[model samples]
Target chain A: MRRELTISDQRIDEQALGKGRAMSAGMGAAVYFVGVVRATEEGRPIAALEYEAFQPMAEHQFHLLFDQAETRWPLESVRLVHRLGRVAAGETALWMEVVAPHREEAFAACQFIVSEMKRVVPIWKKAFPLA
Target chain B: MPVSVLVLFCSDQAVSGCYKSAVQVRVHFYSYFKDLAGLAEVTESVAPGSRLEDFLQKLFLRFPKLAAMKKSALVAVGIDYQAGDYVLAEGDEVSLFPPVQGG
Candidate 1:
């Protein structure tokens, strides 16, 4: 089986997106979330946001999150992709999809996963203001 | 014994009649911490049996600014958040950062 959780320095590609959302007949709901980098940080203009991570730890934490969500909800498929290095403003920084048997499970699990990620994930962002 | 006592005697023997082993831990700083720490990663000597929670306090000697964020700092031993009481050992990779947003 392929890895459903990943952290990459390259941009999130079409190939990755294609594989994550594949659903079986048993699944009924899918929640897709995209988090973009804004053009400003602290109300000032910025060129881009530079992202960095302890990749090995980041991947491990995501898997833990996936496991936690699975036990709480009837999940069918889950995919989470986080971008590293410099991501331009208005570009994607993170993308996630949670699929379950019902919309309620999908939404709850997605929110739980993202909330835990923000609290525990070892990722950081730096704003390189326009210079 | 708490590592705090050993830390005060770090310049002493490793395991003499009244001493204990000291360890070197690899610590990685992130986000604002990297800037405050003035370096990405460094190997710091830790008193034998120091817990992960004591890391920020121990590290403050070198990077005082980082300790200022202790109330808001985030620490982890790999993927899991290690509490202050989680005893750390040599060869451990620790990440110390401000509240984070990755993974």
Candidate 2:
């Protein structure tokens, strides 16, 4: 898989991230996971969320997680992009796409990537609850 | 006889024949810490041979509101995750991160 990890303060380009993967004819499945800023947290109404990151190290962790994902499954392509700074409720904060030859492997790898990213990445999100 | 001369530089006043100096460590704040601290970055001076824990202790002292997060927060020196006891160096970039909620 042509693995890529990107972190930016600007809006995430969904189309660009989901497109242009050189998938082999044999590879048929593609799975994507987009994490958005929810309107509430712990039952409290939220207005927005502000994201911050130790940029360099966060990128490093993303790359490391991709390596782990590749080792665990047979993947065709992968892309993980996360946005930093203020993200209003319902806006996309994270985008992940995993491509594999089969649906099972694609789903599993996609889930693994998101979980590992949350566990290890240095990025953080702060909620702004509504009054 | 050949002898090596050692140089000592102190920023604090010498007392009772003892010399003391403080090393300045620059810290960068993020997320809620930034909101609480009301600033993005600040520098704190600690005694020589101070560890990351000591710096954090001093930080919490200055910003008591941040104390609650000490247990879950992560520390990074430069671009790598560092243990609490990691010795801090002068001009080293120290970052305090709240428990990451990113996906």
Q: What docking grade does candidate 2 earn?
A: medium
Evaluated on the second chain alone, the candidates' TM-scores are: 0.74, 0.78
**What TM-score does each of the candidates earn?**
0.85, 0.78
Worst 10 residues of 1 chain A by lDDT: A1-10
Candidate 1 segments whose C-alpha is farther than 4 A from its true place: A1-3, A14-20, B1-20
lDDT of 2 by residue, A53-83 (tens): 8888888878878888899999988987888
- How close is chain A of candidate 1 to the true chain A, as a TM-score? 0.92
Interface RMSD of 1: 2.1
Model 2 chain B is weakest, by summed lDDT over 10 consecutive residues, at B9-18
- Residue-pair clashes per candidate, as listed? 1, 0
What tens digits encode model 1's per-residue C-alpha lDDT throughout A2-96?
23876887887746696546777988998988888889999999999999887777788888888888889989888888999999998888888
Error of 1 at B31 (Å): 1.9
